[model samples]
Target: MFSGAQISLYPMADDFVSVIMAALTGLDPWREALRIETDDISTLLVGPPEVLFAAMRDLFVRAAQTGVHCVLSAAVSRGCPGEPDDPICMAQGGFARDLALPDRIAAARANVGLAAVTGQDVAAQFSLYPLGEGPHMDEIYGCIDFLKASGTFDRSKNFCTRLRGDAGPVFATLCEAFTNFGTVAGHVVLDVTVSANSPSAR
Candidate 1:
């Protein structure tokens, strides 16, 4: 019965964000929450299925309003700030970043946008460093390091990271893994990926 959706409200109206949050707050008792950066803005919400859904509906209504330019989409996401991670459960969040196109992500998962991404098992294919601790850091440098270190390291210890689970379980484990990445015991960006069956991803 658990479900969620992602949306984009064009015109960059700040009130849309507030209104959406307000609708969600009316949905369920939030256990955890974070800001999910979308193509337009970002917010991460985690909570009960009923509440999450109510909020999603409200968001769609408001977004599709006469003046509010809106584009809405739903999918099988695992978790977020709106809901806290249930240690006793198996559902988890899948890690994703440097999103070229989240809407197209589903297509990529369907093996459509592979050429654009130019990589696979991307997390494993890259290296990471602290934000400003060395001659090599930053987003571009991190991407370079990631390409350079392909097939060398299992995980990097620069920025904090959250472990992604199988596609099926990725939705529920976000709170347990990604949402609280800031609380990780280390001060480095953690390189993480989902544990799934696939090729060497070279």
Candidate 2:
């Protein structure tokens, strides 16, 4: 499967440049191991699941270390049907960004509260926008159904769902939602914001 992710790192601080740099720096160590492209909108990463998640762990943790409110918004997919296979996704053998802790655990650990995040649950807000296909609302509802089955939904917010759980499974489900909607449809764009640790939260 060819998997790719588009991510935007927003550090909630007046001096956010340093925070963004720190997060981008985290990916530097793994530059050779992965294919990363950055534009005005988001950074695109194409790689295997292990490498992709490992890189995300380092990137987000570095941003979180700044101690400011940081949110990571990602739209990830595993090769939409009818799209040409990206050769880079098939390439293998890449070193992890950090060696001290395992990839999954490292990312999960970073996604906790201000002082030592226990319970291992991070709150995420998702608004999936289904586009370029038949009945946009239908696709949206389909995603909503899957999200409701997997997490919690805020009734007042249309097309918006909030999920709290381990970073691994939550992210896995989010990725699946993209694939589910993108399979036969034209294209679906996902708006996702995940806060590992919110300084304002009590």
Ten consecutive residues with minimal summed lDDT in candidate 1? Answer: 118-127
Query: How do all models score by TM-score?
Result: 0.26, 0.60
Q: Rate the local accuracy (lDDT) of all candidates.
A: 0.31, 0.61
Model 1 / residue 99 / CA error / Å: 37
Alpha-carbon runs more than 4 Å astray in model 1:
1-7, 11-40, 79-84, 87-202
Residue 85 in model 2: lDDT = 69
User: Which numbered prediction scores highest in lDDT against the true structure?
Assistant: 2
Q: What is the lDDT of residue 140 in candidate 1?
A: 36
Report lDDT (Cα) of residue 94, candidate 2. 31
Query: Residue 87 error for model 2, in Å?
Result: 1.8
Model 2 has an lDDT value of: 0.61
The residue ranges of model 2 lying beyond 4 angstroms of the native Cα positions read 1-3, 14-18, 25-33, 39-41, 47-54, 75-85, 90-121, 133-139, 151-156, 184-186
Sequence-dependent TM-score of model 1: 0.26
| Best TM-score among the predictions, by candidate number | 2
